[model samples]
Target chain A: MIAENVAFGIIAAAMALGALGVVRTKNVVHAALYLVVVLAGGAAQFILLGQEFVAWVQVLVYIGAVIVLFLFGIMLTRAPMHPKDSLDNDLRWPAAVTALFLVGILVGLLVHTFHADKIHLNGPVRTADITNDIFTTYIIPFEVVGVLLLGALIGAVVLARKD
Target chain B: MLLNEFLILAAFLFCTGVYGVLARKHAVLVLMSVELMLAGVNINFVAFGAFHNDRIGQVFALFVLTIAAAEVGIGLAIVLLIYRNLHSADLDDVDTMKG
Candidate 1:
């Protein structure tokens, strides 16, 4: 239990710091790299929660595919590698105030809702059970997600192709 | 770790993403921020799913992941298109639709 707590603390700290980097960094490439750190920290949190399959999927999809695509977008668009003052708009102060307010409300609500609850990590939901549920109970949504992905692919090709 | 801890962490991440979305001028960075927000939601889903010992949260998380992937693809494609036409990825510069 102590080990789990320690792991959670460490992962949470990394995630917070990495997210700070993502937003604060001026270079787009640095922001993308920071995003990778945040994404990896998220996967670590999933592993600590004992959802192994989801953890691996998080690593594979977010770290492997998504961030790579972000990097591709960054490079292809020729975002400036050096720090630039123009990376942010004039609404930084307002944005910061709004974000802090949202965070306060969300954290307060979560604490009020689940303050006494403790999640037992021993009884993890297995991959097989998840697959069964997805195939049987959520089959329609699953197929719809498949179609959505196909459409996204075709749309991307069409939108990105040079005329 | 208590459930509140995870919830608080997710909340922090979500707020960070929100700030990024509202403040960043680069369109790709906004997309990255969106990814951060989705990651926070995924954490919440997995945490609740683990808490109840149910498979639904993880299943839903998978669906979220799929949708996020598709979103990034289409979003970045749009970003690329904007860049190709305007030669700029800054969100504020793409005001051609303004009245």
Candidate 2:
């Protein structure tokens, strides 16, 4: 239990720093790289939570597919590889204040409500059980998500095609 | 092991994403921030699910992953189109609809 707590603390701190880098970095590519840290940390968090399937899925989907897509967008759009000052808008201060406000409220509420609660990571979640749930209880949503993916694919091709 | 640990981490991530979305001038950066927010939500879901010993949270996290992928696909497509048209990826530069 102490080991798990230490692991979680380290990973969570790294993720927080990575998340900050994602938002605060001057270079777009650097921001993307920072995202990789946060994403990998998320996978670690999932493992610590005893959800191995989701952790690997996160690695495959977010780190693999999504980050690649972001790179393509960055390259195709020709974002400056070097750091720049104009990446932020004039509303930066206001946005930071808003985000800080949210942090105070959310963190306060969560600690107040769940401060004593502990997650019992008894055993790793079975991938087979997740599959069963998806196919049986969540069949409708699963199919809907499939349809959504198909639609998104078609829409992307259509929207990105040259006239 | 404390549930608040995960929840607080998620809240911090979510707020950072919000700041990114609101302050970033680039469209792709905004999309990336949105991804951050979704990731935070996924953490919350998985944490709650684990706390309760339920598989539903894992299932929902999978669904969130699928949807996030689709969203990135479509969002990048739109950003590409905008860049192609305006020759710029800055969100402020694409205000043709502004009165």
Stretches of candidate 1 exceeding 4 Å from the true structure: none
Docking class of 1: high
For residues B75-94, write the lDDT of model 1, one tens digit per residue. 99999999999999999999
Instruction: List, for all models, the DockQ compared with the true complex.
Output: 0.90, 0.94
Candidate 2 ranges beyond 4 A from true positions: A83-85
Cα lDDT, model 1, residue A19: 98
Kindly list the per-residue Cα lDDT of model 2 for residues B1-99, writing each as its tens digit.
898998999999999999999999999999999999999999999999999999999999999999999999999999999999999999999889999
Candidate 1: residue pairs that collide: none
**RMSD per prediction, one decimal?**
1.0, 0.8
RMSD of candidate 2 to true structure, Å: 0.8
Worst 10 residues of 1 chain A by lDDT: A121-130
What TM-score do all the candidates reach, one by one? 0.98, 0.98
Per-model clash counts, in order, read: 0, 0
Error of 1 at B21 (Å): 0.2
